[model samples]
Target: MSPPKLVFYVTVVVFAGVVIFTRDLLYLVRTETRYGQLDQYDHAVRNKHHMDQANLKILRAKAGLVHDENNIELNLTLRFQVNGGENEVRQKLKYVDKTVKTSKKEAASQGEITFETPSLLTLFTTWSGKGDVNARTHNFTLRNWARLKPEVNPVLFIDDGYDATVAQRLGWKTHRIPKSSINGLPVLKDMFKVIKDTYKSTFYGYANSDILFTSNLVETLVHVYYDSFYSDNTTLVTGMRTNIVNLTEEEFSTQTTLLNAVSTRGQLYMTSAEDYFIYAAEYSWSDMPEFVVGLIAYDNWLVLNSRYREDHVIDASRTVTAAHHTVREPDYQSHFRENAQYNKVLFRKMMQFHVEPPYEKGFTNCIDKYTEFVDKKIEIRSRKLEDPCLF
Candidate 1:
């Protein structure tokens, strides 16, 4: 009934519909394959930053202090370095009143910084080479932090495995907190109280122990942590978006469907209880790191509870947190062997290594792994240092 031109137009429209329909059907098949949604997420996380690399000793909780009958102002260091090479290279250090700074670029790499205040909040690594770095902003809370001296430590926390002579010989102070925590929460609470009482503030960073600094991670964190640029009203900081890390709106809807089945939050720990739930690591069993979703939920809660923007970031780089809970050769041989070989990597790369318990007395301990990883990285960089583009 239509003219020739009209008929041609209709044919064009119908063909377009078929093509779009076919394309969508293909996409549906691809997304539902065994790899499914997670494959896409892996690529997103891996690209955040090249492998790389905070001292703000401030906490402002209403908690009291040890000095005052005192809550707990403390020096917190996560012993993370496993020195397995030649002899121990103890470098010279310079100490200022409230500030413990190294004389040279690498001086702080293998030294300790002590805050005499009963309350100090810091995220320092166990290994000297791990690097103590924080922005000058955090140091604003220090009292005369720039008094110069050699090897100054008021007191240090000693674990069951610390080299006792090092702190003693250094003329530093040391007090040990015997127990560790789930997600470092217990130790941190004490540390938080210690700092808060001294500083009369409650600024805290529940950060990773492996976070070493070649550059100032503290500076970057302060910039990002307080900057209002990336966020808007009613939004939360999820940091970098990782693959499969953030569920789609639909996946979230289904997660809700499954979440309701749990009677208690702790019951959600078992994957069998619900695949949607992931429980705490041994140390985190009680308080837990809060699930990715829960972290976001907490952000919302924090936003609601206070007018302040307590931005929490889940994404940093491998250098910031290469692996959580050490992954061993056996693990690599099994879980990640074919990761790169796949057309689409199946699992999202893990960020931090959870320290496995029942400590082993060997060079291959978890601390050793981090040092080895760092050394290898340094070696690789040294080789490429000549390239003008690298600088």
Candidate 2:
């Protein structure tokens, strides 16, 4: 309680704060400084610096590899649609049957041909809203993803009321699931099962249809495949997405051109969240709750649960550019309001219990930042670090 003692304590506290802040500042400087030419978008450039910094920290966390710390190991395997009219469903079924046969023949020709599935499969659930932009974005996305990686098969699952003719033309396996709904969200648990049973790939990825991807997405997946630290099947992959509006189909004629466009114009927003999810096909999800896509907290809960279950969940923002091409937000209808309510209730439980996923240690905010939970509570600085050093 003496004056001298008080002064000494304050000095020590200030010095410690200065040390932490200065160290963090140096880290940002090293990672955010761009070596290449800047772009026309100033905000985008600044945002990209923050993004690149966060991504660098994430990549550096797992022994200098991109990974999240989770103890479980499921084996990384492969095997691998949605809505539309009943006719679209029928077309999808026919396509699936034909593709399965063709895949068998291809495997047989390669000699042993023991496994009946491919290495990877990607699924996109979307409804082409009443606009050319959405449809055009879908066209570019499907086309780009179809040829994104030759080894990985991509399928388009369309919701009812939307047409899949364009997708069919792109040679993507287009399927329409039954229009059953829970909370106005198409039942995805069963839908996921159907795709898994049919394609039987080693890995399965679910991405929004409006999200444009380059070849780097597949190459990043390949990087995950080769990662020795979290190479096991129990790994779940997701990443921060850059939002780029009004990108035309012609801009994406090739991966090189598309990536260049994204680099120059893509607005670097939405850090530490996910737009795409790629995971081992064998991971169990029979109990996944009903979640309408594009609604708030649906994706957040997935990250929380994955962390709770000790699965290796990674943010591959640095390695993959999962670009969101549309500018318009979804209409807020009564049903959407209901979904938001469900999200609120669910998130409350997630926050109350303070579910700590592996490797995260004390952090609980799964929305953004690789934050550290100190004193069993989230501090202001916890939110400040774009990529807080886990050490």
Candidate 3:
């Protein structure tokens, strides 16, 4: 039990201790390797899930199932992919195109869409009965108006018991004028009241039955409607007529023939002769006098009243070419007619009752502004008032 026995026992104990420590180290290494592999697999699965979500979004956008905001972003991304030579993205865009066409067709078939446009302006007139020189002239006028765009609605207010065969044939709306008149002539204010009540239009116009307008009439109104100057105010648009003597029905058969005749034979009338009046829907005719149409003083009085109200009184002479067809020279002495005198008397009465003393003269010069074509575009220019009566 001396030195030799003690050494052998110590060596055995040391070797056993070394073996146990080595086995424990190997176990620790194996556990760490398994955990690392599991972490790598989880990361790969998470990346695959993120990629699937992105692909679904793109597919939804291509199918037009995404909201507009998302579609916008998707469109930009797809466009980029298209530009980057991605043939698959290009095919997706084509599919989206086909889907859009199908969707539109489905909506249309279901009555979910409409393409009908509403009329923007209503042009109206009153004329004498058939079987007269006036009737022939009115026929030409109505036909000329029928050639205008559908946006301009043409209506003929037939005098009570008068035939509207010509207007009806031209597809114009026909209605009987109220029996209210002075000396068998329809009152201007009453006619306007009827027009306002019966029709829905952005603008209303009353042209003399003999007046022929070019397509510029509609173009001028469109410009005025969008003009910022008239945005906050009611407007009264009037212009001088171009008189063409003995303008035959043959001469007015087509717009081109009519314009050629006008360019050669037409003479611009004096500023005092305003044959047509166009006013905005917001214009008030409540205080207008019961002056009969086709009479003197009434048109003048209207211009004066519009100016008095601080409305936008625009002289459209430069833009609108209103052709007045005259079979014979107008009788200057017609101012002495009974209806003319009646209008004058009515004007005096309206001035006495409604207007202040030192009444302003009612004329084209009283207009606050005038329209003209600048570089082929309509422009509103302030008119310089040289007449003291206008101020």
Best by lDDT: 3
| Native-to-model Cα distance after best TM-score fit, residue 13 in candidate 1, in Å | 56
Who is ahead in lDDT, 1 or 3? 3
Write the residue-wise lDDT of candidate 3 on 278-326 in tens digits. 9988788888878787677678788888777778888887767688887
Question: What is the C-alpha local distance difference test score of candidate 1?
Answer: 0.23
- Each prediction's TM-score versus the true structure: 0.27, 0.59, 0.66
- 1 or 3, greater by TM-score: 3
Global CA lDDT of candidate 2, please? 0.51
Rank ordering of all candidates by lDDT, starting from the highest:
3, 2, 1
Better of 2 and 3 by TM-score: 3
Off by over 4 Å in 2: 1-116, 128-133, 178-183, 328-339, 347-391
Looking at model 2, report the run of 10 residues with the lowest lDDT sum: 87-96
TM-score of 1: 0.27
Which digits, one per residue and each the tens of the lDDT, describe model 2 over residues 1-391?
9999999999999999898778667644543442111222434433543556666354233211222222111122222211221111110100011111223235323321222344444555655343545556666677777764334567766656667776677667766754445444554556576677777665777777678765445444544543443434577777666666677666677655666566656655433235777777777776566665645555656676776666766666555667777755323232365545664355555552332212122122232322121222111121332333232
The candidate 1 region of ten consecutive residues with least summed lDDT is: 57-66
Residue 80, model 2, lDDT: 21
lDDT of 3 at 29: 66
Write the candidate numbers in order of decreasing TM-score: 3, 2, 1
Quantify all predictions' global Cα lDDT against the true fold. 0.23, 0.51, 0.64
